[model samples]
Every structure is written in C-alpha cells, then in structure tokens.
Target: MSATGPAGRVQPARPGDPSHIGPYRIAGRLGAGGMGTVHAGVASDGMRVAVKVIHPEQAQEAEFRARFRREVELSSRVTGPHLVPLLAADPDAPTPWLATAYVPGPTLNQHVLAHGPLTEGNLYAFAAATAQALAAVHAAGVVHRDVKPQNVLLTPAGPRMLDFGIAHAADGTSVTRTGVMTGTPGWISPEQYRRGTAGPAGDLFAWGALVAYAATGRLPFGSGAPDVVAFRVMSGEADLDGVPAALRRTLEKALAQEPGDRPSAAEAAQECVTLLASQATQVVGADAVPATAVDMVTALWDVPAGEDPAWHLPPDRSPSRKRLIGAVVLAAGVIGGLAGGVAALLPGSTGGGTHTSSSTASVPPSSSTGSARPLASTAKDDKDGTAANRQASNGGSATAESWALTRTAQGAGEHDVARAVLHDEGVVAQELGDGVGFSPKSVRFQESRREVYLSYTLASDEEGAMYAETEIARNMCLTVRDVVLRLHPDLPYRTYVMVKEESGRDPQVTWQDDFVANSRCRSAADDDSAQDSGTDQDSGADQGWQPDEDGLGQAMIPSTDGAEIRVADGAARKIIAGTNGIRRTLGTDRVLGNAEIKVGFDPGNSVMYVWSDYLEWNQEQVESWADLAAGEACRALVRERESAGSAWPYSRYAVAEIGGSGYLMIRSGTATTRAACPA
Candidate 1:
C-alpha cells in the first residue's frame, strides 16, 4: 500500500509498501488538502491506518519542511492511545510522508454528518478522550495548535486525535512564523488568532467548541465564513444549545476567553468520566450494576490512586491505564516528603505500625501505594550562600554578603531596591514599566567580576494582590533568587537582597560594590597599552564585561597579549593571549571561584559578547564559553521554586548576555520583563 499525494493522487505502490501502516493496509483514498492527502491504508497485522504525504508545493517550502520535521519529532516524543501514534516517517526524502497507526473509523465531522448528532454516551467519551490527548500533548511541552473535528478520528476504541503538524513547544520554538494562525477557523481559540500563542488552555477551548459541535451537530460559534467564525471566537461567544446540563459548567469554563480560566485537560477528563458514570447509573434504573458498569466504576474509583495527579487518561482504556501507572510511579518516587498516602497503596503492603528495631517502616497495600516523592528531588542541589558564611568564619578565602530591602506604604519599591543593589555592585540597573500601578520592580547590578538582576513585587491594597505584598514578598523574592544562584554555582552573578517597603512612597534601596577589583577590570581601563597591540584579538575589549560559563559570574581581563594566570591554591597556567578562547572551570574545590582568560590587547574598547544556555558545541570549554556568551542577551534568570511534590533546583533561568562579546551572564528575575531578542 503506497501513500496518497495531494488532491487524492495515488503514488505507485512500491516494494517497500507492505500493504500496511502500523495495523492497516491501503484500502482506498479518503480525502486530500493543501497540506497532505490521506490514504486508507491497513495495518499488516489487522488494523486500519491513515497515511499522509506532503503536497508537492508545500514540500518545496523550507518552512513547511521544518514544520514537517518538528511534527515527526514531537509525535515520536509523545505516547497515548487517543493520539494517533506516528508509525513511520521519512522527512529527509524528496517527498516526505508520515504514517500513523491506522484508526478504523470516520472522522468526528464525517460521523456527525452521517449519523446526525452523537448520543450523550458518545459525546462524553469524546470529551474525555480529547481532553486526555490534549493533556498528554501538553505534558510533552507541545501544543496541538490545530485541533478540530476533522482532525479527530472516532473509532470503536475511542476518539483518537490526529495531525500535530502545527504543534508548538510551550517554552517557545523558532520554527513557527512570528504571527501565523494555524487551525480550523470555527474551532480555534482567540489566543491562537490574536497573539499566535497557543498553550494548553487554548487547546481546552477548542475541545469545548468541538464538544458543542458533536452535541448539536452545529458549529459552536455558529455557521459562518472563516473571518466571521474568528470574530466570534475573539468575542468569547459560544453557542451551547444542545450541550448536556452535566457538561454545561465544564464547557463554559473550558470556553472562557482567558487561558488561565479554563480547566486543564486532566481536570476536564475527570469531569467527563465522572459525568458518564453518573449518567450510566441513571439509565440503568435501580437494578444491580452490570459487569461492564462495575469495571468502569472500578476504573473510575482507582483513577486518582492509580494515576499521577497530573496524569490524564485518553478515551482508550489500555493506553490510558499504562500512562496512569507510569505517572503514579514517577510522581511517588520524587515526592517522598508528601507520599505518605500514596505509599500505603503499593502491592503486598503491611499496615503502618511502629517497629522496635529503628528500621524503616513499610506501607500497607492499596491502589495508591507506589511512592510519594516530588520530581525535582532528582536534581543536584547547589548552595547559594558564600563558603565562608556556609562554614562560619573559617580561614578560607570565601566571603559572603547579604543585602535586605523593605517596602513601606508607598508604591512598590522594587525599582529603587534594584537600582541601589546594582549601584552598590557597580553594575547598571534599569527600571521596568514607567514605574506605574503595582507593576513589578527590577534592577540590574554589576560587580568588578559579575552582574545580576533582582526583581520583587510590592504589596497592593487589594486582597487578591496581597500575595505580592508585605514581609512575605521579600522572603519569596529572595528564595527565587537564591535558588537560581544555587543551580549555576559557577556563574558570577548573585541576587543578595529582595525587600518590600511599608512606606507609601518608594523605599530606600542600597547595595555594596566589590571592595577589590580584579586584573580584568584594571586591564579594561588602560587604552594606550591595549591599543599598542592593535592586532590582538581581545583588542575590542568593552567596558561591559561578559559573564563566564555557568551564567553565574563575569570575567574582565586584558584582551591584548596572552598571559600566565594563577589562582588561589592552583598552579599558574599559560593561556592564549590574543584569541577569544578563554576557558573558566566551575565548582572545582569550593562552591564557587573566579578565573581569568587573558585577551592579548587592552580591554578599554567596548566589545560585544553572546551567551546562551542552548548553544550547541562538542568541546566542554567551548560549550561553557558559548553559554556565557549567549547569557548576555537575557534580561534575567528564573529558577522553579519547590512545590508540594517537586524540588526544582534549576527548572529555568532567564539571562542577559551582551549580544556581540561572546560574553554570557545569568541573573535571577522574571521572563516577562526580558527584552525580546533576535533568534
């Protein structure tokens, strides 16, 4: 069975065509579109498959080719029964084609068209399955940017989601066009059309609209041209005429225009499944529950216990169960601090009781007894305070400093605190927002060897805004900054103080700069000596020094001639003089240390440095250098705070690296304030 091309054109059946894709063989053609053509292929074993081939015209576009590659990559990373499994793909071929596990059934659109509106049972099943699929896709950090009835396959097994060609990663990706809209007009969310940012919630909105279509056999936003449908979506109007009352609330919430207001896919699935069970009870009358009903009841009851709190079950029974178990185990292992309830549900467990010999106690048997640890425990912890502070006045070279800021009744003192901190550190600081109405405050600071940013929110009078208010604000701010510094111990940057002012006006902000300047800073100040070696590669040294590897620190040294450098308790070593290749090793003996890479020429002239955590390189030094260089472009760095079941030491970091210097630095702060830079 060969693949089909655009407009339902059939490609010649070749020797490689095994008459199947996953479980289905080529039976005939179903349809075609501008993107690809679908062929009715069958699985060699016994199931049916749908194979899609890129249109000749689309295949010619480099952008389309990149998107196609991403589709394959994302599909390969996710596993769920409700999601059409990518059985095969050959993106490198002149005519790229992808084959998915055959789902022997009509699309939701076709089914609704042929059989009128779906029954309550079918609709509930559809909702649960779709939500589960969306949850799985989102967990993998990818959003199904295109979700609609035409892309949903209704099979005896359940509703299987197909086509993720336009999926986008939540962390952001470079492949997508900046402002392109992708997906069916009637079913798309407003966010998708407006900012072109489709996250997990956007998919939920589409799911709600899709459910409405299944129930009433009409578009949720009413029948209209693409433009009109888009207008309705943007306006937050959804027609839910025939939707069941049990699902009305859930649908309404899911269809909310604001992304944060929508229920997560897992929550939606649970709601749907619960409703279906309740409906089944009503239909069966007062008679004894049937075996099928009993099984479903068992599954429903065991869902929370057997699955991860984050686990979402697809409509398909087998795969959903597998995912549930996997999620349960993974969640349990990482959240040990909170796994007491879950530990009791393991197999062959004994009841909780005291043991006389001081041995570890075992848990009782139950569905939830796997483990109860958080996922973040797996990462290594890096201490944020100085070694001297950590060791309490030891004779070691390490010294630690701590700064505090407090806001008074006045507006948020974030900017003031930021400026003070940066000034004390001898680094530049910039205030974000025109310093208006409860906006968060930010400051950039630089020492002779490092630069960092500290961001904190002020308390607002409103009850809802108090979380960002008061003494807790300073604590929270410091905690976030400390976590980031700990993760990248090698980086020179450190955020020491975060304060909330109680005064109505901006509070006083203060900081301390380095008492001793390094050789790098001294060399950067000399021009005549630096310019004498005009040929020196480091001759372009800028006053703005680039951060070193690990995004924790900065390095400033003469870029003129290579020189021998010595470190505390370390042998002197000769490094290249003129080139930009200066390597700094991190976390060698103590928690942190400073190193220098001598550039041959004087460092007075301004130089541009680039730093990025994502830079690709094979050599260790080069990779770290690249990270330092790329960090310059970032405005701030944020690390995930520990939660009930997770301890993230370094979930994410926002950094700002000087664009041209190949210098990189990481600071603790919010991503919202980071200035957009070219990819």
Candidate 2:
C-alpha cells in the first residue's frame, strides 16, 4: 500500500474509519479495493506504515484467508523491491490486517493518467523491474493473478507490484470456485477466463498486457463488462492498437493463448532488462534490488530470525533442501530361514518353492497395512481371504474409478521408502535362494495425477537371477497397489510399481497389466508362464476347466475352482453368438471407430474380457460407453442363451467399467460366467 497522496490521489479517510487499530493509529485512508481497505497509519514505535485491513464480509470466508495466507507466504519469501514486501500480518484478527513497508508513490494507473503514456525506455525499465519481481514471486510457486497498471506503484526506484490477495499456487488448487471469473477483467489471461487452472504463465500473460497498456495507453482486450472482455481474451482477440514494434515482438509471445506458448515471467523480464542493462544499473537506487531473478528473491527477503512473518511456505524442490532436518527409520529387511520352494511359500503349507520357516504373521485389514486385494487371481486359494470386495459403501454408488497407478523409478537413493512399503511380511512370506533379494528403494505419490510410483533396487546382482527378480518385481506391484488404494481410497489416480534391473539403474516395469493400472483384478490364473518362472504354485494344468478349449458347458464345470455351472447342451454356441452381436455393434466405425476389439473367454467363468484399442479407460464417461457397448453385446448373448433354454439376465453379466491408463477395461463378472452358476 503506497502512501496514496505523496505522488497520487488525496482521498480522505472514510467517515466510519476507526482512529486506532491494534497498536497503530490510523492517520488517513489510502485506498479501498474489493479485497481490503488500505490506510496510512503510525505504529506505536512512531514509524509511518501502510496497513491493509480486510472487509468484514470477505474476512468471514475461509477460502479468502487461505488465498491471503498463501499470498503472504509467497510474498514474505519475495522481498524484491519491485514487488510489495509483507512486513507483518495478523490475518486471524476480527478483521484481517497486513502491514507493508510504506512507499510514497503513485500507481502506474495514476502516473499514466496524470503524466500521459510512458516513453519506450521508461516502459522497458518498468517492465524489467516488474518482470524481475514476478520471477522471484513465481520461483516460490506463487502466481500474482492480478497484474495490471493499478497494481503497480511507480516509485522513484522503478515500479513495485502489489495487491496479492488473489495469488495462488503454481500447481493450482480449488482455492476458488471452479470456472468462476477472477482477477481484474481487461488484464486477465485467456486461461483464467477459460475455466481452467491459471498457473504462473497466466501472470506472464497479464504482464504482457500491462506492457501493452503502458506502450499504447489502451486496454489489450478493450474494457467492458467482464463477460465480454473474458470472451475476447479466451478467443485470442486482443486490441493492441499502438504497441511499438520492438516491444510488440516480445509482448506477442507473452500474450499467447496457450500457457505453454508464452514465455515465463523471468524470461520476459530478462529480455527487457538485458536491452536496458546499462540504464537499469542506475535505476536500482539505494533500496531496489538488481535485475536478476536470484538477486531479487534472495536480497531483501531475509528477516531477523523469529521476528519474520507467519504463513506456510512450500518446501524447496526436494524435502532435503527444505531445512537441515533428518530422521532414520528401521527399514530392516525380512529375516526368515527358507526350507521349501517359493510356490509352497503359503502359510502352514509346503510346496516346491523355497519356504520360510517362520511363524505366519497376521496382518491387519488391507486398510491398516496398506493392503488391497486384486480382482483376478491365478489359482483359487480357500484361505486367500476374500481377494476383492466389489461392494461399495453406498451399494455400488461409484460409477467407475478413474484412478490409475503410474509406476516410475527415477528417484535417487529412494530404496528406503520402497523398502518400507514392501517391508511387510504377509502370511505367505518366502525367501528366494542364492542371490535374488530386493531392497525396497523408494515410492513417490503424484497428488495431481493421483498416481504413486515405487522404485526398488535389486540387492543381489548374481548371474541367471533376472527372471526371479522380475517375478519379485511383479509381486511388489500387487502388494504396492493394494497398499496405495487402502491408504488413498478417495484419490482418482493410479500407481506404477517398478523395479531396478540387476544390470543398471534402468527401471524394469514389472507391473504394466490393466489390473494393476486400474487397481482391478489380477490375471494370475491366466499366467501359465508364472509356473515356468520357477515359482512352485498350482499350474492351471491340473484344472479340468477349459472354457476356451472344451467350451462353456457342464463338462467345463470341473475346471472351475468353486463355481458350479448348470448349462444345457448348445449353450456355448448361443453365448458365442451373443458375444458376436456385441463385437459387431462396438466394432463399428462410429462407436470405437477403427479400434480393434479382442474378446477372450475367461477360463473358469462363463464371462469374457472384451478389450478394445479404442477404449479410453481413464475417462470419467467411459463407464457409460462400456455399459452401452457391453450391454448391447451381452443383450445378444443373453437373448441367445435364453432362446437355448438357459436362464441368464444381462444384469448378471453386466460389465464393471474400470479405467486404466492405456489399457482396456475388463467386464469382470460377466466376461467369465460360463453358464449361470446360481446360488
């Protein structure tokens, strides 16, 4: 809040203005805006100050304070002379008030109005200072959503950027209502008006507009009702009537409609500062910082210890750089003597695999242990403890999950975090022989994408152990997926489980299956290759079921683990006909376009898994399309089954649409149902 009267307007204190606020005495009102009212005051220490006190109604809104606090946090980190400095703040007061270092200056709006448009050199210098300030602000991941002439205070030492009550994070969050218009109209960025998150690039767009405004003395998108101006900005129709050629080239790129197309605030400022480098040296004066990003941010921002202002500042790029703090957790590996093969590693059982002679440790629910059950399984285990509970809390209230898991292995020294995640000793704990142990490395959670990436380094690098290590990596994917869903059930994201190969630091993405991506069923039964992977588990070879080979009749019932099918003769033909109907309907040029649809018979169940290249499983609306496509496909199959004297409803064979990052959704229950196994 620059003292309004020194070089600008002399507005009197309002009739209702208070004489005293906190320990300061209000001398006069400086200005009033939508966010708050600024007043020139005298502190108890006899220091002149500019205090901004929020309006009562706006003070009551929690989100306003959240944004204010975010602004304060970012502002405090940035003491650039061109940007306003946050001296002290008491936002929790009945009416929030923040103090800033008093500067006697007129805003660019007032300066331009009184002194006419700026000369080319003056405009370039002002843009340099503002850009330098913005670079510091943005380096702290803060975006000054409002960047116009009025927000700039034209002091003798360049220009100072102010009014940060509407600042937001660089990643963008719902600090404000979605799609609601924000910031001053004529100066707002196209993305800000287009119902999307306005990032740091938005501020740069505004900076471009401000530069244009100074150069031409006109609003870029012509002032009008916010709706009209927003329309113009979103449509890329700004009225740059008189911008000079040299400035126009730089400003045009800054005013690009796409955020990615625009230059960063730092880059734009550097261009102008570089052109006027000789003149800028004299412009810094005694208080203003020089024209570099680092100099602006690190210069006047430091406070004298505990006296520094209060507000949450985001940690530096990495947690390690945040502060000098450290902790050590007991990430010790599992220690158990092996007696049998890996396959018979199940609790209280002995198969061919190397078994651990350790007590079966009871794990709490999947929620407590971050355990999740996959939808599919290789072989049926009586004590597998309910693989997946399809029931939602509100009776299947969920449409379909858009959550996906993204696994990556790029973190340096991330073995500990990964070790802790895979550190659990489940009921079926087994130790593989010789040199095939994995040390849990690291796991990363992507909040925006809602995906988790886990990286594991192979503790052993012996020859001929790649296959065993890869299997361990596969197992980790299942374990990590269950853990992530159990922990973050509400997130609409995915998890990627990856392991470091024995040879190098490259990630061996062990779990890329649709089940892992969508957090759905596992396909262990279909993985006859797992037996050849040297794990001693029940190979599907002994099962009498062969829906694909023997067809889905009573004869295939023996192959099923527990389900009992009571299908009459010729039931397979009818089911095949019904499936064909769905294939033709979905495979048409319009529905899935030229995408190939692969329909495979689920081994034990009469159900099937319909995969299509056209399926965008990650989309929120994919479930409806899946239901429509599967419904039509199953309608024909059901109709044929009924005509063949079988009692099967389309509802019984309904597909539960699940989204995978780049995989086709599975129609779980109905895709494998051979011939109606009634309860």
List model 2 lDDT by residue over 1-679, tens digit each. Answer: 1122333222455545666655556766554422345666565565555566665544555665676666655555654556665556665677776665454455566566676677645766676777887887788766667677766766544566765433332111111111122465567677665544667898899888888887777777764223334545766777677876667888889989899999988799778766555444445553564656434323322211111121121222332222212211111121011001100100111121121111121111111111222221111341231221222112321111312233332232122223323332111122442144333334554445444454444444333233433344344444444433433344443544332433422233333332244222232333221211221123211133222211211111111110111121122233334434555443433332111232323222334333333443445444534545454444445554555544342222323321233233333233222233211
Query: Candidate 2: TM-score?
Result: 0.39
How many clashes does each candidate structure show, in the order listed? 95, 43
Model 1 vs. true fold: TM = 0.39
Best by TM-score: 2
**Model 1 over residues 221-259: C-alpha lDDT tens digits?**
764223334555776778898788888889999999999
| Cα RMSD for candidates in order | 28.2, 25.9
Task: Give me the runs in candidate 1 sitting further than 4 Å from their true place.
Answer: 1-28, 42-47, 60-63, 165-181, 284-679
In candidate 2, which residue ranges exceed 4 Å CA deviation?
1-16, 33-36, 165-181, 278-679
lDDT value, residue 172 of candidate 2: 16
Scored by lDDT, model 1 comes in at 0.39
Q: Highest lDDT among the candidates is held by which one? A: 2
